[model samples]
Target: MQPVQMTPAERAALERLVEHARGDTGQSRRVADFLLAWWNAGQCGSYDLTTAWGVDDTIMDDMCVVFRLASRANSYPETLGCGPQFEAIVRAWRPKLVE
Candidate 1:
């Protein structure tokens, strides 16, 4: 499937998340690339992500890592769990595509 075109808000949110992941540039870039690919691919489901990203059954964990890293970078309170936080962001930025 062709990737969905992102809205300006979604694009900005993604860029902000990438910026927050301020660790190794290479690793950050890899994650960012993965995210962009994922989003473009019409917000593929977990199964698709697992197969495409080679994440095996630990796709949720990987998502947690991304969320945690992003939260840390942005200094958001760690109250919200990774999945919830990610979903919230996705909803806010791309409600139509996420569902």
Candidate 2:
């Protein structure tokens, strides 16, 4: 299926997430990059990539770590709440990233 388009709000939220991710430590940044790449590929509902990357099978908990890292990077109280928005942005940006 074709990816859905993102609204302006979603775009803004993704920018915020990226900004937050930028401040993460090395390991956390690796996790964030993997999440972003996976999300961008329209693969948010599974942990296959995480497992392949040697991430713990408990991906939800791993995502929480990413969220915490992002929060620390950006001082955004709302950072942890950005998962849905990030997913949307990833879907929207997938074609561009792939090309």
Candidate 3:
């Protein structure tokens, strides 16, 4: 599916809504930024996401939400296509650091 192109204003409004819906905390914001950067870097794959969290899945869902929203805003096809991959990663996420 072709991503709807959002105007700058629309994009900002959606971003604000997402940020607010996700708690709008410092850590949330930082995680959102990190995901955006990672997506922009053309990075993907279950292994990459797993390593990115370092086995601590505390914020996995929230990060996935941020990633989805950012993907829509930027029309990133790869990230958008990875919904199932993201879910799988979240499902298998470990609660503590992997040794």
The number of the candidate with the highest TM-score is 3
Better of 1 and 2 by TM-score: 2
lDDT (Cα, tens digit) per residue for candidate 2, span 1-99: 323344454445455445444453544344455556534325433334443354344543545545445444443323445566555444443435534
Q: lDDT values of the candidates?
A: 0.42, 0.46, 0.43
The top-ranked prediction according to lDDT is 2
Candidate 3 residue-wise lDDT at 84 = 45
Kindly report which residue stretches of model 3 are placed more than 4 angstroms away from their true locations once superposed. Answer: 1-33, 36-47, 53-55, 75-99
Ten residues in sequence with the least summed lDDT for candidate 2: 38-47
Clashes of 3: 0
Tens-digit lDDT track for model 3 on 1-99? 666555555445434533432444544444433543434344322224533453225455545555566656565424335444333322333212222
Better of 1 and 3 by TM-score: 3
Give lDDT tens digits, candidate 1, residues 29-82. Answer: 344445433433346332234333533334334545544444444432222223
lDDT of 2 at 64: 56
Report the error of model 2 at residue 23, Å: 0.5
Error in Å for residue 53 of model 3: 4.5
